[model samples]
Target: MRHADVAQIVHTIAVETNTPEETVARMYADTLDSYRADARIHDYLLLFAERKVRATLRGGNSNRH
Candidate 1:
């Protein structure tokens, strides 16, 4: 997916989960970076990042890491 699509997904997740967009963006960037070295398909990168972010936010562990 494109960067804009990923940004929109992150923004939506932030709003839906009541988290700050900036925080979500940072976490998303981190998540993306973590998988950057992997050999997985690039198209699914955002999906993986989104799931990690959503889980982290939902679990209320965002502040810890």
Candidate 2:
């Protein structure tokens, strides 16, 4: 995994859990297995989803078909 992904995960979990960095980090490292494996796997989904979103947005710039 990329450092970017880990950083994003850390920041996002901080916002979501509304906890201190230490607690959120500990939870992420220790209790992620409390979630399904797909929870971790789906972290990669943002890459494709962002690409699709950008493509859609770019397509919108064309007023003509």
Candidate 3:
């Protein structure tokens, strides 16, 4: 997916989860950073990062300020 698409996904997820967009964006960036060494394709990388962001929101793993 494209960067704009990912941003939209993050925005949607943030709204749905009632979390701040900045926080979610930071988490998404962090997720991407953590997965930087992985050999997976770009699509999979975005999928995994988004999944991590979603899980973090759903599981209350984020600071949520």
TM-score of each: 0.77, 0.40, 0.76
- List all candidate RMSDs to the true structure: 4.0, 11.6, 4.9
Better of 1 and 3 by lDDT: 1
lDDT of all the models against the reference?
Answer: 0.81, 0.48, 0.79
- Model 2: per-residue Cα lDDT at residue 65: 13
Regions of candidate 2 where Cα sits further than 4 Å from its true position: 32-65
Ranking by TM-score: 1, 3, 2
Indicate whether candidate 2 or candidate 3 has the larger lDDT. 3
How would you encode candidate 1's per-residue C-alpha lDDT over 1-65 as one tens digit per residue? 77898789889989988999999999999888887777367877667778889889888553322
Reference-based TM-score, model 2: 0.40
lDDT-sorted candidate list, best first: 1, 3, 2
RMSD score of candidate 2 (Å)? 11.6
Which scores higher on TM-score, 1 or 2? 1
Best lDDT goes to which candidate?
1
Expressed as tens digits, the lDDT of each residue in 1-65 for candidate 3 is: 67899789889889988999999899888887777666555647777777778878888553321
* Candidate 1 displacement at residue 15 in angstroms: 1.0
